[model samples]
Target: MLGIKHNQHTNLYARKCNMKKHLSALVLAVAMILSAISGVLAEDITTCTDSNGIVYQLSEDSSYLILKNAINTTGPLTVPSEIEYEGKLYTVKEIASKAFCGSTATTITLPSTLTYVGDMAFAYCPQLTKVSFGRSKVALGNRVFAGSPNLAGITNYSGVEKIGYGVFDGTEWLRTKSISTVDSAVYLGKVLVAYFGNASSFNISTSCTSIAPNAFNGNTTLTSIDLSNVKSVGSSAFEDCINLSSVTFGNSLVEIGSYAFDGCSSLGGEITLSDTCEKLGAFAFSKTSVETADLSKTKIESIGNGTFKNCDYLNSVILPESTKHIGNYSFQGDSFLSDINAQNVLTIGYDAFRDCSILSDKEYFENVESVLSGAFDGTIIYEDVNGSALVIGKTLYKTEETEINLAVADGVKSISPYAFYAAETAQLLALPTSLESIDEKAFISLSDGTIFVFTKNEQVYSDLESLTSGTIYVPEGNTIENENVSVGYITGITITKNPVKTEYTYNENFDPTGIEIEVNTVLNGKESSYNISQIGYEPSYTYNFSASPIVTVSYCGYETTVITSIKFTSVPGDVNRDKNVTSDDILLLRKYIAGLVSEKEVDLIASDIDGTIGVNSDDLLLLRKVVAGLVSLK
Candidate 1:
């Protein structure tokens, strides 16, 4: 009784594509040789019957889709590696896309000379019981037997390098009796399996380079293991291996993926990563019972959220200086984890280290900017955002922004998610270092959409609609994502925040507080201003004024007006110019203190670039630097 469910069974066979990129030229050469042996492997055809009583034919000569096109019947059919036709040898060279899809075939035997298998080739082959890769030099995929309902067995005799993606995607049979490395393969050391049956003991090798994802997804009985030479591990490689009490990595691997060890409850040991690895994908070491993992030499830039969920035994963690940021909720679910020390981290992502039961040690929260929602909801200490970490152009940006513009620090590697989100209308934004990723709803909600900044991570920008409804601009960079029109205006907005600046807005007729201002009227940015008191007599006229400046008048009882500022050089000899200096400066005239202003600055009060205390020639030069964009005094 076979039935199709909407959405559940849609396009199960859609991914039979064998881009075959990972397959080396030597493998192709081997296939060509085998084809040549078949006397032009283009003339032979294998005639077989499907379970639905339809006669089908596969021509091994010129086309790979020959048999797939004639499908009608369905059953557990084993297409032979070689079919004898007129006493001539014909190689089973190709398998078309979704050829055996939705068929009740319970077993499939790939021919020894099969050179190509199309994408989603056997998807929905519901009753598939076994899939064996023959002596054909090609590698087998983790997806080959995916979605096979009763697939209880799989074995590839070839010495290929990897288990491709989506292979064995939804098979029920797990818990290996024995899986070991054969010829050509150096050694298949840690093919970790999940508990499926009553198997008590298992075997492991010392030469395996990777552990397949979800290899032991539901195993409960497998308790202890030793892997000393394993190099690389894939995502969720040992996920849900419930009974895995203890395990360790071999000495050679560097990179680990998200959720590599997630759900392994009882593993307790001193686990450390090799110095050579660079990428620690989203949740690579999640949900394990390792007491203290050492990450001293890792060059990690971002720590993903939920990477350590449910790890109850973690009491301490030491992050290396090479780390720059930790993503949202990266350490949220660790119920027993207490302390984390990260000295060089710049921005803690949204809710990063959230709910960390005992997170008050001071080593990780130092020098941080833009803590997102719930970042310290239950932390033991109150840590403030680092005002100094807000930088632009490789130096801390001390000036406030009516808008965002990160023109220079192109190599800056972190963004505090929604650092400067504000209430005023902004016109421009600039993003550099090819942005990495944006968190959920990182942008502010607005009626009119605005552009988003960019770093270079592809996955982050692929589906940006999850952030907001406003239009966004994503600049093109060295590494680009989809380049799609569906994702708002993907254009690079140039930041021309040079010395030249101005702004204006029009109003209705007979405006009172300015110089002939009216609705729908515009003025140039370089030369613009308003004339105050033209409509009424005003008292404050003691300042440099620009011609035709824009005026803003609001009523809070009587109306008060605001206008644009004109650049003006300060009076040279005014020590207490605006009378801002209180009697406190007179009582502090001690010796030269480094934190305090110097005597030169005190002698020339007008030259103080910064308004704090004394002023001198250093202060004079600082004033010049501020105008020159080298120093800041705001």
Candidate 2:
């Protein structure tokens, strides 16, 4: 039981459309002005049924008729201005409210004598596309054509005077029309939906507060769009318009939807946003030819992801102090981006500056506090030491291609992560005696490179030992204790304890009759127990424990043991086990306190001996005291 309704107000858009004849042109005019103002009911009511079984409530005196409902079916309806009711001719003055509110009629033609269209009379007519309004049809009701998204072209609305609100509320016809002239501007209520006239550059009407999404999208002819009075621009509103060069924004625009100006490659002039713009949507100006995006005067708090991506010609960007974050890939592929002034930025997302190859080291780290990985991939870095190293700020990155016999420059105390990473050309690396610290992966991938140590300092060499490959060549007179390089025992090594022979022999037949094996700390997944009776021995055999790995041993069941060693990674109060405290221990302590030290680098419990809470200066001071012989681990 579907029905139709005509609301009490009319759509005042009147135009002569030159569409096909089968598609009837509708004329929606202002509501019943003459009769309502004059306070006159044209005729008395009478009921009648047409030959097609359609019911009509007619007025007897004025011959006015209202199609109330159809008995069998609704038609591509034709409402005549006059109809014979019980042989009495009645003039159809108006369609009553709810008369055809939800009718499925595909076409409707009104008579010239019709007037006073009632509230919601033709509302919710889904298939009611072709509609022809009579010259006398005047008044319209609210939502008269509401809920009809496909209601097609309407005809001349020249006779219209007062239009009601929401007449075409749910229709797509309102959004697809060209902007009409000032005398015939088409509007959805007060909102101007489209423009019909020819103008190279256009100004949105001051009467319109907002421009609908895709209103001017792909409109190639529109060169410049001035939105001085508009409050918001919808998503993709001006997208793909290659010729659109300039856009003038009003003070009222606060929110820009995503992809608003994407692919406007020829768009020129600086994208100087107003101070009122707080939210900038993703890809808002992506791939545009704008030379600069000076956001210093605006309130935009963050630059969205891929916002300026692939804009190869963008030379400079000025971010405001109000901006706190830069989204991922925001400035990626902006090859010409040489200047960026984000002095107040705190966090930069991954790949934000990737492929922005021209940005100098000074501009890259100006105000950046934390950088996600790959942020500077494929970017430029100045050589901190000419012909020696490619540098990011004061941190040494990698050496130049030609320098294989590396002499890490003096004053370079710390080797930054990935300093010599993947430099297969580097066959020999010579460390300076002044070198203080080297971060992880600083010497990674230099597997075949020979490390030359100028400093006899064991701690300095220890930091470099596990990080490099091949043999390390120490300077003449520099002693590398064999215990610093080997750890644990290969099978068949001899055990000599005090008060016994310097070399021990094993017999397979005796089950621990003379010698006993006691296990202590063992490397992960390595052997912890051994059957002494089955153990084979060699004369004067020895196991050099690298970093001094120690194990207790007994000969002939005596408790007196002769072997002694220390493991640097597991040793307490000896951060680097250089046999003495120096700047290395203090540096490790500081690194541990800074959350930059890994457990494999130092024993946590050994590092935090004071045991207050997290590692701090007090623990460092206590460790220094132990190093100074004021305290002991026991």
Candidate 3:
């Protein structure tokens, strides 16, 4: 029995030892697997230096590698698209910032897989002369080749999209290539890199699709540029080109980068943009001399900050319906900018039109969702005679007076939003002929009994008709027929000057040769005049020599008559008072000359055959000769 118990204990101890051994083996295997994973992760995040002294590091996401630094690299360097390391293939996707800066590489070849070249990637590389980009499209960061004095050659950048500011500045390539007369400008494939020529005018190549930043910056000699085929203009492309007076933008142009034409003081005339242009960058035309900015044809949604700022000659700006915002200081300091049509604008930024002294249309901001501080600082404002109505620019902003006749000034072109909303007690509101538009809800608060008197402006009348439930009155014939409107000839007509010839014989037509008719009417409570012909004036009268006749002038359903004396007059040769000249008249003239009839009894003036002072024997002789048909009276 003791021997059997010993055997059982030995078996149990063996089983326990076997279990412990299995557990130890399992723990060792797990440690090895975790170590392998840790190694792999470390390797993925580590930097690698190749035999050629080029350094590279795995990207943050571990999908690709970035060429980090090539400072120790020498001779011609070729960056492969795929680099093999530890039996793994990784794509070289980017050239990191300053990767090749201060390197001794004489020539460099970039890989087709490269998507980005970071800022100053090849800067300060004095010995680097040539660079070849295998891929056409890449995002080039700022000053990529700046300070590379000997670098002069570049190839294959046609499809590049984003070019940072001063990419090729201070490079031998830009200095020599830009001044070369071969193309008159430095071009990186189809991209216009720079213009260093002395030409006063330049026409960009039709093949160029993009303009690099600072391409024409500070160029004093260039007066005009024709970019008819370019699609994009980079930031500061033409900044401070003070002498550049004319720029012909193409229909293909879609984007203008920030500060593109800033400080171009000589740029003048109307700026006509194509509908295809969708983006206008900040300070694009600031400090220019342009007279008008008619961007109504563009598809741009915003006017960027300082776009037309300090444009001394800019007088008019027509914003398109697509425009939703006006950025800060857009038209600020444009003293001559008197008006802008921004009916579709949703918001206006700070100082958008500040210091625009003549800007009068503050009504444009009435419906905007946001209007920042000082949007209209120095604009013109006018007050009515009674100080009840306030007008800004050509817009009637608001009125306070009630239960009285209100007449808007003649130059008020628009009625601002809610201009008359509080004037419910106003019985008569007269608008001038100069009114062009009435903003939404302009007359919403007016009562049904409030009468509106306005002249014939189709747009104003239509707008007013839609706003007010009150009665409208227009001049008789000038009325735009509408419901709840009264049309009566309140106009008056007066014959200011009668005809020069007032005397008329029997059965003669009354001539109005020298008639001066004045048609006067009350418009907006102010006396106004209309041309006689414009009022359809007609003159009507009957001729009667028996007494003074009345000449009546009719205009706009109004009539006025003028009375002038008309004396009875005889014919030149009627001596018998019978209105006939014959042998009897000659016998009567002879009797008058022979004293058979007194001078007063006969028609002495008529019997005078000659126009002498007195009728004597010469008159009788001429009368007898007249009877014989030998001679006639003078």
Candidate 4:
């Protein structure tokens, strides 16, 4: 019985040892499972070394592999599109940010499946000369290839929609690629990205609608441009094109963006704008060599700041009737501009005409309403009133210093050329009605002082037409018919004679229109009335008459004049003539805002009653306020 008990105990001990061994095996399996699951859940990044000794990370959730970094290599390296790790394959989709930043690689090829490239991924890679994308649909982050000025070309198979700003900001070589695969030109959508041909002169394709910003920037070899189909020229499009001498603009072109041709110093000769051009952005022609710019045909309403600043060789500027405001520094540093015609300009910004050294004292202020300080500098200025007036070649060059008011002698028929050039003293000047002509750029820099004219003869209107600032007084029977005849600027001119009423009737009510009348007036008290139309002196009168106008004659000795008047005979706020202040007026206001019509199309005085002095969106809002009972039209 003792032997049987010992054998049973031994069997029990064997069973216990077998249970411990099973427990150990079970624990080992659980630990292995937990470790494998944790590796997938917590440590998802799988590191692998490529054949080229480049380290790449493959994440389980990632659809593609990422190139983390590369080992030092002497030659070009191409990244594989697919990476296999632990029995899984991941397509290389993106190059991680800063993956190859400042790399010394001479050339690199992106994978075919790459869709995204992080910022600065390969930036500052000085030796990187060629970058060829295998696929077309790749997106680049900001500055992805910035600071790599040595890049010869970036060949792509497809177009990228979202290109970050400054992606090629400092890539100077991209501007002068003399050889391209497609007509030596690169395009991004409908815009011309760059011209890589060696041709000095280029004609844009008809299919191109616009030129991309910096498209041809820093292209010094380009001598001329022919843009017959482009609608808009982007900002900095031709900046620093030092050799560009000629430009043939397209008929469909409308807007010239800021700095479009900022530094084209060789573009000399006559420059004229077509009638379709409506806007000229700031610094559009800054630092150019344009000799003469005639904008008479353009419909541009505003001259942007620095539009012609530093145009050292610019000699003449002809502003059109559509111009309203002259922005600050528009003509600053134009040393040679001697003549300027800004007939419809209302507001002159500060430094608009500053630093025009040789620009004569010929002022064209026929319609100038406001003149800011420093508009004219670097020109001759007449300071003291005490000394005798100095006349050079019939031009009053300078005057002696004096504190009292000044006056020209009665027989002084003309103000000398450039007289009172850049004068900025607060002193009055008296003029005789006998003064006939004043040279250009005269009275340009005058102070806010009064100018008294002691003559009833209305022929003197031509002499005072260019007086921008300073009040002027004329006879009671004469009137200065100009937009600058404001309350503070001009006074004492009146029309004592009653105007003859005339009318023109139409089948349907129409917008107010201007009428031209050929007046037969006798000059020098002679019965024979000369036709001045042959001499370009065609007087036109505008009237809202209900019937055909009847000719009215008047005799003024040297010249006879025909005059008539027709009034709208409507309330102040009735812009649309519906007899009510409604939304129609707002529509008209919007039309004016969109540059569809001018202030003369509507009631100018009433529209200006919004207290803004000009017809703009503010006046529209004020009229809307009146309609909403938020404010009064009065």
Candidate 5:
């Protein structure tokens, strides 16, 4: 019994030794993990002040450092290229926004590793006089040196790729440099910063490669500019230059920023874009009088919003084949604009061509994949025949009524984009055989219940199948199979040939003998024209002796007018129509010949007594002789 008890005690001691060893191993593992976590936390420190009292912060991914703030540092601060923190080195890549604002630094020297300077980095520095940029190109944020009253010099800025607005505003650098020479322009390296002079025909410096924003804004006296050496024009550079009529763009020109030439009302004639020009920003040429814009040589891919809006005299625009998108109101209110080449345009924005009264190019939207609302509104290509429907150059632009079945007029070659957008619940839509293309979004907003009845089988029917869930039916013999589908409506009429006998006596009936009227009707899904019998149809008009009367020819609820003359039967030498050649008529004729009486007051036909096609002194003499019965009234 004593030996067994000793064995049990030995086993318990052995189990206790194993548990102690496992606990020690766990403690060591946890300590190592904690040390690793603490190391990562140190590196993750978002912000820290360096030994020189300059604040620094980690970049978004903690891969680099950004110089955050040094406002407390006084004169001649030089930013280091790299900052060491927590035993690790990080490259200082950027300066945070407002980093040195309100500082008393006399000068700032940026390191070569810096890529960007945030907005207002050194702004409001009262004593700042100079900023030395790095060797590499740096993108500057807005108002970088604004309100720095003593700042007068900028060094190594030739590598700057972008400069935000008002960067040098309220600074000694801009003020002194702007008027330093007879040119009255400020040049920051190769960039033309600003022009404050009132020269009417100023030429840009030959050495300039770029122009800064608002460079020559609101210059009323600048009538012409020679930009033969410029490469880029910044936003609002020439805005509101009311008299800037001539501009010579060079081949090196690449970019024209937003509102660059906006409101230059006198900028007329052909504007030939440079072949290297790629970007044209929003409202670039809005409200101008440019007669023709030839962009075929440019590399522009899209036209921005309001780019050419309200250009009253813009007659033609030749877009490059590279163009894909047209933004909202791009060409709105161009009244005389008639021609455009946009065959490859993929998307058109809202009101892009709205109120372009005479724009009638049929193939402009052939390959367009998308079209926003009112793209072609108020154009002359479409006629407002009915309140809800329009016929645009052999295309049905839109139909809004759902109560009655819609019949597309015959000879309509296409259906415009979003033609049935407003008629979502429409029952039936009839299509003509003349359709060759259906534009994108033609059946948008249509419901499944809507039926499309085509007069003949067409490839467009297959295209429509992919666009909508509506039922399509092609009838036989150029007629709609469904009787409910209304067809054969009169779309329009034309006065092909006017009456041969236009002249008639006052109060005479309108003679329809020589009149030829061609009536246009949609019959059995086909456009048909026939000459209405001249004797069978009577025209409606009121006789006017002085002016030509408009004769209205109405047939099948469609009407068109023909202009014809109906004048009073003139009696020779009877200037006053009293049915006699008397002394009163001779006196009137004499007064007309003397120029005392106006042409309208006297009957010119009656005053021409010799039938010489005019009322002159010779006619008056003949009338006087007739009144005296000298040669007897012929």
Candidate 6:
């Protein structure tokens, strides 16, 4: 029995040793698994310390830590414009390319010092709906928020002149949005045109005088304009605005620059021009397809070159009676510009009315005298006249043409050097025979068929007239010919040399008349003491200036205080040389002419008479005597 118990105890001891070994194996396996799990968790979010001993972020040492990375973290990242990590202020210059492509941002407010933004920096951020840029000009990088399915905000800063190419490439989910004024301010900073894709419409404020060039260009949604306060419209300010349909202006608007509404073919409104407006710049309303222009009260002074170049729909226009100037190519190539009623215009710039063919019945202005170079070069006026274009030789002219009663105003003596060459607009023209000269290129730039007409030098001074289609009567014995066409496309070309002709006859006649005067002095007293009581006389009236002077007149008891100042009645007189006189005297001319010659002058008519007696027949006699070389009158 003792031997059996010993054997059982040994078995129990063996079993305990086996249990201990199994427990050790289980603990070792569990420890290995726990270590692996811990390693995976730690690897999930990598970390890296910055140069300032502050941790930025990290996956791999070479990975970038931009504003929007691939990391999925609940974040409200604040990127300071000027980073002050340690002590130095470094610009957080770039949000690397495609950096924050799809970040979940509630609101993104940028700092002021930011300079560059990487392309598509904030693209496709579903939760990022609002963003505000500080003072710095924000360049809308390409595809910044392209696929943001729920994006709803639109920037309207005035400083961003150019919305970068494809800035909203895939922003298809935008809803319930209008451009913000801050965005407009940004656009202004960039001198960019205000487009209507983001903003439904636009009407410029009165305070804003000029719309920047290309300001509203390429905006298909631009519908209408109220230019009440706009005084000037810039070049190409609204080019290619397919949706622009109407336009109206206040009296304050004066000038419309080149390409003002070019390519705006949808326009269909009447532009009312106030008399207060003076100039219309190049292409002011060209390509607008305007139906009418109200110029009843217009007193336009100048029309810029190409002011209505391609506005083919307008057929009739009524210019003001005071219209004076037209710029180069003012109505060139306008297919429908049929009528013009320029009244007192003097100068028409180059190619003023080229290609205007349908204009047939045009007779409104009177006092028609001058036509500028290429004034009607390629218009129907140039193409239809039976003969050659009119010849108005070189020289700047002040007064322009009217429908009747021609008269050239001052500052203008002749036509432009190349006024009308090779132009065949008129077959016959009757010029003022009093016209002394015709300068070079006076008959240039015309069709080849027409001829210049003139009458006898003296007869032309008669009533001014023109034969619509008839014979041309040039000066006698003069060699004139149609200008050579070698000069490319020259119209109204007629070259005339200043030829010597028979001298004009003039007659002169003169008649002489004489007057004499003699004054008899029968003074009884050696010293005459007589008080002169004479009313004032005008400068035009004759005075006894060189009459003799007595020492003293008969002092018959101090006669009634002898008031020197008195109102006297008289006829009219000439004082100001305006050829008439009344109380409108300048008050000084009478004194200057009344024997008041200064001794410094040698040629003055000096008439010295004593004021001792009244101005009677004796004084008149003395004045006539002076005129008869008996005395001098100053």
The TM-scores, one per candidate, come to: 0.44, 0.39, 0.50, 0.39, 0.56, 0.38
Candidate 5's residue-wise lDDT over 487-542, tens digit each?
Answer: 34445668888777877654456776666765455544677654544213333444
- lDDT, model 6, position 221: 73
Candidate 3 clashing pairs?
Answer: 360-393
Query: Each candidate's lDDT (Cα)?
Result: 0.48, 0.58, 0.72, 0.63, 0.74, 0.45
Give model 6 RMSD, 1 decimal. 27.9
**Order of candidates by lDDT, top first?**
5, 3, 4, 2, 1, 6
State the lDDT of candidate 3 residue by residue for 451-494, as single tens digits: 43445677775775563355455655665455554433346667
Greater-lDDT candidate between 4 and 5: 5
Off by over 4 Å in 2: 1-148, 151-172, 175-198, 382-634
User: Which window of ten consecutive residues has the lowest lDDT sum in model 2?
Assistant: 9-18
Q: For candidate 4, write residues 48-121 as lDDT tens digits.
A: 55434466666456655777775253358677676544445577777777777777887787777787778787
Candidate that would win on TM-score: 5
Steric overlap count per candidate: 49, 46, 1, 29, 0, 87
- Model 1 spans > 4 angstroms off: 1-99, 103-120, 126-132, 136-143, 146-194, 197-203, 206-210, 218-222, 229-243, 254-257, 275-281, 297-305, 310-327, 333-349, 357-382, 385-634
Ten-residue stretch with the least lDDT total in model 5: 1-10
How high a TM-score does candidate 3 get?
A: 0.50
Cα lDDT tens digits for candidate 6, 1-634: 0001112343453345345435545765776688688764222322222211222232144233333343242244445443222223244434555666766764566655445556777777777665556666554554566666655554434333233333444453222222444434223334333444445566454345445555676778768877776665656777788788877777876666677787889886577787677777677777777766666686576777777776778776667766677678777777787766765666667776666766544343233345555556555554443332233322322122211112122222344444333344432233422343444444333332222222233323121122123223343343233233111110111111211221111111111111111111112222112111111100111112112111111111111111011122221222233433323322323334454533222111121222333333333345445435655544
> Backbone clash tally for model 2?
46
Tens digits of per-residue lDDT, candidate 2, 327-421, equal 88888888988998877776666678788888874544554444444556677743243456653333345554443565554434456555565
> For residues 1-634, could you state the per-residue lDDT of candidate 1 as single tens digits?
1111113322231121112212333465776788899876543324533223333344644333233531332555555454322234345566666676667776666665665555567766766777766656544434555677677666664433344456555665432233332321122213333223334344545545566555555667767655555555667766777678777555566667677777777677666765655667666556777778677776666676666655667777777787777777777766567767766777665555666667666545545533555555455542332321243212222213334332323443334434444312223333444344444434444223343344445654653545433334443332223333223223321111211233322111222332321111112222222221222212222111222243333211122334444333333322333433323232222222243644433323343446555543455445445445565444
All candidates: CA RMSD in angstroms?
A: 17.3, 23.1, 23.9, 23.7, 24.0, 27.9
